[model samples]
Target: MVFALGNCALSGQIPIWLQNCRKLQVLDLSWNHLNGSIPPWIGQMDNLFYLDFSNNSLTGEIPKSLTELKSLISGSSSSSNHTTALGIPLYVKRNQSANGLQYNQASSFPPSIYLSNNRINGTICPEIGQLKQLHVLDLSRNVITGSIPSSISDMGNLEVLDLSSNNLYGSIPASFNKLTFLSKFSVANNHLQGAIPTGGQFLSFPGSSFEGNPGLCGTIDSPCRAINNMGIQPAISSGSNSKFGRSSIFGITISVGVAIAVLVAIVMLKMSRRGVGDVVEDLDEETGRPHRLSEALGYSKLVLFQNSECKDLTVAELLKSTGNFNQANIIGCGGFGLVYKANLPNGVKAAVKRLSGDCGQMEREFQAEVEALSRAQHRNLVSLQGYCQHGNDRLLIYLYMENGSLDYWLHERVDGGSLLRWDTRLKIAQGAGHGLAYLHKEPNIIHRDIKTSNILLDEKFEAHLADFGLSRLLHPYDTHVTTDLVGTLGYIPPEYSQTLTATFKGDVYSFGVVLLELLTGRRPVEVCKGKNCRDLVSWVFQMKYEKREEEIFDSLIWNKNYEKQLLDVLGVACKCLDQDPRRRPSIDQVVLWLDGVGTEGTKE
Candidate 1:
């Protein structure tokens, strides 16, 4: 599966050459900087099972050719199988046998087509009805206009349908009552009017699904009215009659048989009572929250800082914005949990961090942490917007960085052009240092995890220190905080392994490793000349002692023009990496030195 190409700074249109990859099954190009209209040839791929083009600059009408995929159309069985571009098999062909047990040949998950969060304008193509096997279809957060298509009811297997945040007007098609398999449906934030459909899955959906559209009526609060001279009110149904035949006699026998089976089931249940309680308890403990929590924990009430656009946010809104925390919305993952790209109801965007594990004193500690972090704000620090707590699960919402993490720009080589220039690098380091200095000034605050991945970048590539989940708030009288070692493997200070304590010096050591990463364009741990893994600090010092400083620095910035500034930062890095914590310079001192380096770069 091709997943998460988002924030990779990939520009231009979808490459036409991709159409040649006939075996491609899953294609995800979400959250990228790609522009231009989607190529129609995408629908020509016979084996394509999933396609996502969300959160891009793509425009124009969705190609009607998408309906041509045979696998997506009902009654058409494809004998072919396909693998992803990486040569990983995604589907296997089933052989036809005369006397062998045969399973249904259709895809179990159902094909999904997502084209949300784009500039794609125009009416949704009526040809969409041809994709009868589609399970999920999302066209939300776009500029698409026109009436809601009644043809969508043709998709019998559709389970999730999102058409929110659009300008579509007119009554929701009453034909939607035929979608019995739909579990999640939303047409919120549209101009649609008339009576909402009743029956089938519509009965179970919450009012939020129909929110934002004031004209629409039926389930929520809007009154129903006649449309196009037809009565729009829900029709009351009367009971119907049926005739009994030989099949009725068989039904009577089946009723008696079911009664006997119920008796047998009760006896079996009584005999297995010794272990039944334990199994039920284990299930409850494992899931932690009930299955209905997704339904009950509507968007948590948002308590963002003033001037933020998400004043009207709630837990239900958060769930809907992130597609119920769908894997497709994941932008990053950490030891605690995953972070999702959350789009607020007011069209503002943010990042929502879902923490793993269970609740203990967390409910109390969570409030304290929020209070402290919210108070400790700086230009170089990421803003903690708000949080959500439901049962044992907790979520921390923050600002969404457009440029992603520094690790990605440095290691993944995603940012296009020479974006990682020496001057920019100096500015980033200085900003991060300033943030560290600001945090250290607080009452015994120690950021236990300080790595490039935790250092996020805004659209301008300015560094923002984040991910303070492992941070310890020391008492006013305490010298250090004793805590379990928690940090990325390569960035963790060596002394931390034995001391089992977190200190400002430890944060300085980790920052030094980040400086080395910036200078050398090398990871904290990498294979050396002998093909053996060596830490960056040892490798850099070894090269320095041997009079090969030029060889250890990033080739892109290793020039006489930049040697002076580079060497000065290298000196600071060496001081920060001192084996003894006492010898390490304070974060405040480091910040001053970095500011000097940045000033020197600006002068030249």
Candidate 2:
């Protein structure tokens, strides 16, 4: 059974006999007035995946035994995975069904544990890292004390982590960079101090997420003071021991003699040419290519997504599957990195993009792509299956797109004579709009780059936005100004060139350019007279002014039957391409207008 007696209003300590129900997967006892400490035996059930004890009068420290659940680490709810010497299975369940709350159920959700709004106290156990497969962990509104554990960083598959309204203290851990899949993170109303972790998911979270913690510093509002030492140390006495007097003079004399001998030996060694050559060789060895991981070991980590078939996945197996990233398996290459097609042992096909660079800037770029893809999930956005890191190598795994990118269909006639139908074109535009709208709505996110080449299509020709290496998450303080200007040439707006600020309106302008590409089927910048060229937006605007709007439509899509609907979409695209950013419509408005056009066609 998945769920036991939930919302039953039962009073008294949780019955220890529930441990005997070994097959229970979800146990939600939230929203009750039950009192007493959570039993450690609850962790003994191996097949459990969901457990909720929120909104109760439960007390005492969270059990370290809860982390022993093997299903939370291996993505499998079976007793055969983690068995104690006594042959008992370790089990755990993540339950959040308190108060009958309805949540947006995406295609998949990872193993989770929610124990919020209780009287629980004591520090979060470092042993929680044992649940490597956990995705959502909420321990909010509790009286828990002590510093946040650094071991929490080891859970590579964690996505939503909320520890708000607690008494957590100390600096956020630097090791949190390993949590590439983290999307929603919070620690508000806590006693956390020192600089906040600045990379990975930390960058995407708005200042609101870290609001109530005044001691915490970094991009968030409050700054930590310069204290000599936070932890208390034992007081030292001024009095000297009688035993120290016996060897003090003798030890000082011997130490002086040994120091002089060592100085003389160093002078002789420095005079030798062979010794200097050896020193230079050692320096070069340390500064050269990354030697952090052994080549024999292949990789250091392999993290799979929630419903991945590669349960027993390993870095060694991935390397062997790609034939060491040989050119023969190369399927695509772009500004981010090279893509290789890999067939895993469970018959799951994936596309792996190998980001190759040792520089800090490149590392940030790789992290941005992973974090953005993990956070923004829409039907029109490509899914990130997982990621791998070893030495200087960084690889991102995504579901393979069979139909390739939108650029291929527009420029290269991959399909011989059959042009994309008008309805299909409208559907692709609507799907892309949904994705862009979602990104624009995110607090700090701005997709700096949006072009045809970055949009991939599936087997059904459903559009999925791809390529987020250039995406930027502005700090909450910066309302509309950012100095770093990064985007494709033709898609960038005129206001961006002068002000160097990225805004939601700027993204709308780029999407307008994409819509124009779909309608006219022409490149952004087309060559005209020698050394001169006309941008697609300029040409379309000029044609509209000259009363020649019909001349610029794609010869294949141009027909009296589809003219009315095409014209309606063209008018919306033109409004998006308005020279003034303020005049351009919001992406949400664009979607409504486009939806109306589709509705009108259905009525006809």
Candidate 3:
């Protein structure tokens, strides 16, 4: 039997009559205005496997009886035909539905307990570990206090354990490293301290999982400092045993002398080579990369969106995955930072962009912009997985693109031009346009930088716009005014030099340069004729004026069959590169024009 009345706006305490439901398997009273402590008699139901009293005004300690549920402790499987046998419609919210739906069996739900977002107090019963089959245990957003029970490590099947936003204190149990199956873990916003346990699943958890605890250390950003003279004896008393004290003083003098000599020798050696001393202070000996130590040690922050695929990602694991951002793993570089290809422990690949600049003052603004970017999702845009801020370093994690950037295909590779057929190139242009159009919509996000290299291609050759919103995130500039310019030199709009501001039309102008690259096999700025240099936009305009447009198309991709479509796209590109920003077409209009290029019976 299942009795679910979640979000029903029910009032007062839990009903006493619920005890009569002797065979109840699920009891959900979440998201109601219910108050008072949970009745201990509810645990008498041996068949109960799912219990939820979340989002309530409940007070008092978590009843120990709840941990003694026989069904959870013994891992008893529910009857497959329980719903059918009762002939009653049972509403359940499982993987199939976020809202409650009629289910044929109560067994579909996991054996779990949710008592979060309440006023529950007191220590968690250590016997909670007895529920060996419980898959989730959320006690977050509460006033719960006391150290976490070490016995929780015995919960072999536990997957999600959230105890965040609580008043809990003390060090995390080192034995928790034994929970190999634990995947999602968080103790954030607590009073926890000491070195975070390493090994097993703990190594996979990101620093965000331990954020808000100022006392925590031993992670990649927060290296633990060794305690000096940890167990050494105090100074010897002088009143008694002068001979013994002298003996002790002689021994201590000899030890101190030898230690001072060793230190002097090390200092002298370091002084002999300043580079060696610098490397020792800043670089990790294992990875030979800069260490993640921050000036404000415990305050380094990392935020991973819940939708991120790398839920178990950690800074340490990311370093290990990318060989400490090794130069050999570098896939791309731009005005922002170097992008390294990271092969995560779970077999998922990602692009780790180590952002450049002093981000100490822009922490709040940077986090806000990144959070907004995380919410902006589109099929043709590279997803922002997460971000980390340690010292002056800022890193943004993105979904890895398999085929690399369009710039590599157009100019870097010797034979890359031949591989991108006319149809494929047109497809990439349309996809990038759609992504830009979406960004220009409500809550108006202007991609201050757009170029061939910023456009990434996936396994299917579909284009995904990358580095969007980063120009504003990293640089201290606004839409209306700026002292410094941000964007590739070749892609900067003419109006930007005068107005010193970024706009949607400026983005369109940059996209036009990318379109020119796709149409004509040339860099945005390249040497034209004998020792003369010109931008692609001006050269294209000059060729059009002289009626030499045919000579402007890439010799490798130009074909008699694609002449009409190529000419139509060239017209669109010219409009986007208009000298006046106001004359340039909006991204939406550009998308419509690109969509029409190959749809009018044009062949590849």
Candidate 4:
């Protein structure tokens, strides 16, 4: 009943809470920057069945206790919280080797082991042979050196043996013939030197598992032929025999024999779907390139991120914080959700965004929105601390913004100039500009609804852009065509009135209107000439071009001494309102302009 924590940028040592999961059965914490040695105490969790802790920076000797666990899956795991610890992810169980191989029948726990993907360097403790109930042994992707202990043959119930991606050196033990229960085996990317097992389950695996081991000659792809003149090409038919049978409730083994007793088996399971080697190419975000990787050797199984999926807050914990959505606690309301301030258990401050009433098939939309926005991790953008998805309800938890929102800073009375200083305003503007620009780049994240209301501020007036409900994830294959009007009036690009979709140009158009709001202290929509202009766009167009550039300033913001600088900033804003979407500057271009790049026309 365990869930995965998936991939995260988390680093540092493993948390204490993980090793002491008394009621826990499954734990996963993989694909992170976690460092340090594996904690030995985790081996005490007797109830665990699936454990993963891989792709980390952990170092030290592999604990002998790991082999004691009776049931363990072959995968990766490690919590994704970065710190300066000397140890981190390494999921192992009590090894039943010579040190503690003395089996106490009274200790009838069903836990498994998973302690690969670390900096651990040492020999496989021969004591590992004592665990009679061991089902899966994975010592892959590590620095564990030395020969494979022949005692491993005692694992009569072992189904998977992955010693791939390691520095283990030695001949494949002849004792592997005793592992009749083995399947899904791999020993790829290692420095092992010797002959792979010939008969029994050893011949079922493909050639990829033995690729890097130069000295190892196998029945599978090597200059050296199989022992006893057997073929080197792997046999596909061996795994189809009685070894992988499933027992039926009626005391019959449902393998090829039993199925043949009924009717002939029609077809074999697709080979590629259940990978025995490298299957597909994937892009690594950090490297910005493609790398070969297998989908998984097993089902939607254990990975590293599952560890955080634990310690999650409950629906009740959320409901109590906002006082059941009381009006006094409410900060703002949006199209698809409402924001509320809440004080939760342990004095944690949180802002909860509750989604609008359930839209039947919108779960994918909800998931997409959360996943997209959650990926943006920067100091300028508001941090999404956590989230909750209960049945029909969707809630997002954000780190509290202390300075309230930009809407208040603008519209609310700046009674004393102290409330919103000129220096702070400039800083806020620069920060907002940078955040918006990042959203416009490759795999461009379009913040479809960018307005002052969505511009939030924290203590010290550090601006953080928030509210990404209408965000879109743009990629190369995207046609960028959609029939939906986004953004507040005036902020919407004039070009968008016809296109009815979002684009980087539309964002620039909106940013221009926001800039105008800063200059003129006017709402996007206001009255002019006894006719409602509907928004600022139409009015600003008139003031800037109709021999009236100086008039477009909010009086308080327009100190006579700063006149030239103000006009220069406003001119940049004016160009952003280009009638043609393509003419608008990109976010990076906007930043350079703000930084005084190509400013001949901006100065007097």
Residue by residue across 159-207, what tens digits does model 2's lDDT show? 7789999988886787886676575688999987667776665766667
Arranged by lDDT, best first: 3, 1, 2, 4
Clashes of each: 7, 10, 0, 35
lDDT of each: 0.71, 0.70, 0.74, 0.60
Q: Give per-model TM-scores.
A: 0.51, 0.50, 0.49, 0.47
Candidate 1 lDDT at 98 equals 14
Q: How much is 296 displaced in model 4, in angstroms?
A: 36
lDDT of each residue in 377-397, candidate 3, tens digit only: 898889887776554666778
Give the winner by lDDT.
3
For candidate 4, lDDT tens digit of each residue in 16-106? 8776456344565666678887777766655455566766687888776665543332211132111112122222223322111111111
Ranking by TM-score: 1, 2, 3, 4
Candidate 3 wrong stretches, greater than 4 Å: 1-300, 360-372, 469-483, 527-533, 600-604
> Which sections of candidate 4 miss by over 4 Å?
1-312, 358-365, 413-418, 477-479, 527-534, 597-604
Please report how far candidate 1 places residue 401 from its true position, in Å.
0.6
> In model 1, where do residues sit more than 4 Å from their true spots?
1-302, 360-372, 414-417, 527-533, 598-604
lDDT of 1 by residue, 1-604 (tens): 2333544568899998888887565676766778899888988877676677887899988888887876577423343332112322222111122121111221222378888888989898787888876778989989889988789999876878999999898888889988766767899999887688886667667788898977667863444655478656422212243234556757966998999899968953653342332121111112223333333443233345554446656556766778777656778766556788988888878988877532333343355456556657888888887666553467787889998888867765423214788988888899999998998896457888899988999989899998876677777777788765456656778787677778889999999999998998776754111222136888888888889888878877777888889988998898899999999999998888888873553221
